[model samples]
Target: MEEAIFSKLRYMKKVLLIGGAGFIGFNITKFLAENRNYEITVADNFFRGKMDVLLTDLVDKYKIRVVNADFTNAASFDQLDKDYDQVYMLAAVVGVKYTEEIPNELIRINAFLALNTLEWLKTAQCKKVVFTSTSECYAGTIEAFDYQVPTPESVPLCIDDITHPRFTYAVTKMLGESGFMNYSKVFGFECTIVRYHNVYGPRMGFKHVIPQVTQRFLKKEDPFKIYGYDQTRSFNYIDDAVNGTVLAMETPDVSGEIFHIGDMTDELKIEELIKYIGELMDYKGTYEYESAPSGSVSRRCPDISKAQKMLGYDPKTSWKVGVKNTIEWYVNYINTGGDVFE
Candidate 1:
């Protein structure tokens, strides 16, 4: 993989988004595809991402191509047609709470994809890889319950204790990062890891808390019905996350490095988030926070100083604005009989 300037990429073009059909992948792919800067290939097996939810027209209009392939296998990834100058690995079994219920599957899926993709990318000589990691990598929170602050990357990442249900997802992702880092050092592969906070917006899985709340609100039910409304979460707006991804991909001298991509200061109580969602949706329902699931963390946030100084990145959209955009999109989707938003 070569380390060329961002402007130079225009001349040497082609991008392959390994899981571009999924949630965050789709967003990143959409941004690049819309600009028609690179001939984009969106490959996915649809294990979690649904083709129906994707903007297929963008493929036609922008010359974006979609291929069905599983990253778990080296052969399938090697067979991919695109010669990518930039590759974004956004495929994974996302969501810590969800991963807790399927730890073995999560470990298998996350680990294998990282291994196979790096192998294929190395074979393809693909340059400038952006691997989307997660804040869950910082598993155990050391701060007192009374302390309201975002967790920095320097915090203790107790990957050794996967027995702690909250640590399952983080442990798997940590392994994935290690795989990428080792491959980069051994093979000189240009890859950057960005640990995303709670990224929420359109096309995310309904199983995710944000979309679940929106769906419940639209169904005329109390949307804030979750366990422990006091649990804190810093929600990263979709565009902000997208911006960070682009910045990381564009920035030089960041190869083989890791950066936290999120708004550290935008912490919101689960209860407050629900009420905000309702207000955005014009929903009239009681905001109720119940006891959270067994593995749910009491607090979740990110320290984005590294991102700000290095990538010149900062979140532009307020929670209110982001939620309103999400709700509007969901409402239109529902009106169009797009049950997929659920």
Candidate 2:
């Protein structure tokens, strides 16, 4: 009996999350730890991803291995095992603020991270990889070419202006999408790409719209300014996004496929989102409408029919419900003196 148990344990699936300490990464780690029996290792630089109480609790409870290293340096890959059964590449310098403030660093870090991972994958014996991308890659297509709403994955990716700083994030993601796909093809390993759309939830840090709105409401901003009031986006709660991502990793015969994981039915305008959040926060404040910042997409929603049919990806959380849950969490966290994280 002891020998049999040892053999089974030896065959357990080994998983690696390259940037697994961040918002989505930590959630994915928690989900897998709770639901699956795989041996999980999280490698992150701790730059943006934090070593907060929540992560510490999960790691301690699940006995998940944590490797702290800067992956942008190619040498850091040496710290991870090469025989993982599954790998998740979620590392990137994301955020519009960064694009506007430090576009050069954004390009350099994201590009090097993708390239280094690809070079490492060339030698690693991992079975499959999931590269998390963003809807920004095709945002230019919608704005510049009048692309259809509820956009499909088949939509061509275009940069509205190569010289614009805002396109830096999308440009790097495009490089990742191409680099991971082609490298996987040549390296004889399976690969899938997931383009996430406005994924938000509790503990997701304050850089996103939801948390920022929650903070503004907490601060009791009178006549709260709602930027991009006319623009629309379909928000995908973190739980639903995690489900789709795990499905992408575990499903069979799906290599080389790109799936847009988002809630198609929950698309709402910025004004609607802000007002709803205001209501949730019990804000009896007036509102001011403002134009969206430059380079912001006018309308954004994904045609998730592909994810639904191919991966059985269905998002269950309504925007209102998700927003309420997110707002509540942020309120509590801030009330209890939670540190602001990016």
lDDT of 2: 0.94
Candidate 2 lDDT, 1-342, residue by residue in tens: 999989879878899998899999999999999988889999999989999989999999989999999999999998999999999999999899999999999999999999999999999999999999999999999988999999999999998999999999999999999999999999999999999999999988889998898888888998899999998999999999999999999999999999999999988999999998888888998999999889998999999999999999989998888988998999999999999999
On a 0 to 1 TM-score scale, where does candidate 1 land against the true structure? Answer: 0.89
Report the Cα lDDT for residue 117, model 2: 97
Which stretches of model 1 miss by more than 4 angstroms?
Answer: 1-10, 81-83, 96-101, 141-148, 159-161, 164-166, 222-224, 283-287
Give all candidates' CA lDDT scores. Answer: 0.76, 0.94
List clashing residue pairs in candidate 1.
226-290, 227-290, 227-291, 227-292, 228-290
Pairs with backbone N, CA or C atoms under 3 Å apart (clashes), candidate 2: none
User: Residue-wise lDDT of candidate 1 within 235-324, one digit each (tens)?
Assistant: 889989999998999899989778888887678888787777777778765665578766556777777888898889989988778878
The local lDDT score (0 to 100) that residue 27 gets in candidate 2 is 94
TM-score of candidate 2 versus the correct structure, residues matched by position: 0.98
